[model samples]
Target: MKTELEKMLAGELYDASDDTLFAMRLKARQLFTAYNQLGFEGTAARHTLLKQLLGQCPDTIDIQGPFYCDYGCHISAGENLFINFNCIILDCAMVTIGSNVAIATGVQILTAHHPVLAAERIKGPELASPVTIGDNVWIGAGAIICPGVTIGDNTTIGAGSVVTRSIPANVVAAGNPCRVIRQL
Candidate 1:
């Protein structure tokens, strides 16, 4: 039998309110609170905390928080990544960001998705998907990357866009559904 965390990582419906999952979330929140409270001068301390919090963090990444995430262990980032303030990554599943990625402020990389049917949603099993951003990708401010979406390398997602689907490489995408505007 898979645990709730295991089921969650597998992208299957799982009980989020399970005791083990709840404890994990609580621990993440505690770390998040401490990390957020640190001043800009405490860069080293912040990095240290982030190292402990995230699944993978290279020495070259900079994230300006108040950052929020479901399970920090499900997030992995490559080197030279810059995540601006107020970034929210709902890593109910894996949220992978590659190297040289620039994520602007208010960007949300979400992997959690609820059931469409109200009856199924209320039954207590929740599902999730992964969100992946390739290397050299620049996600503009206020953009929301939905679950199971993949942004290819060198792609630029416009500000305030809601990306509902995968985007190919070397293009500019924007708007509510985030269509490809042009190729770079």
Candidate 2:
């Protein structure tokens, strides 16, 4: 039988109240607290903490403290990435972010999504989907990237946009539903 974590990674509906999953989230919260409490000059220490949190962290990346993520092991970030303060990533499933990405403050990259129907939602199972962000992308402040969304390279998502669908390469997108404003 697949474990709850296994099921979650596979993008299947699974019980989130399982003990092991709960423990993992608790551990993440502990790490998050420690990372967020650091002083502004504690870059080296913050990097060390992020190495312990994320699945993979390249040598050349800068993430401003006060970041939050679920199951940090499911998040893999490439080099030259700068994630600003108050970033939250709900990485219930895989969250793959490529190099040279600038994620502004209060940006939320969420992979967890609940069922629409109350009947299904009240049940024990919850679903998750992976989020992919390509290189050379700039996600503005307070933007929310929904589950299963793939943002291509060299794109700029304007502030406060909610991305519900996949965005292609080399474009500027913004708005509640996040439409392409122009090709860059």
Query: Candidate 1: global Cα-lDDT?
Result: 0.94
Q: Give the TM-score of candidate 2.
A: 0.97
Pairs that collide, model 2: none
Q: Which pairs clash in model 1?
A: none
- What's each prediction's TM-score? 0.98, 0.97
Tens-place lDDT per residue, model 2, 1-184, is 9999999999999899999999999989999899999997988888888898899998788888788998898999999999999999999999999999999999999999888899999886998999999999999999999999999999999999999999999999999999999999
lDDT tens digits, residue span 1-184, model 1: 9998899999999999999999988888998889999998998999999998899999999989899888798899999999999999999999999999999999999999989999999887999999999999999999999999999999999999999999999999999999999989
Q: Which runs of model 2 end up more than 4 angstroms from their true locations?
A: none
Cα distance off (Å), candidate 2, residue 40? 1.8
Computed on alpha carbons, the lDDT of every model, listed in order, comes to 0.94, 0.94
- Candidate 2, residue 70: the lDDT equals 86
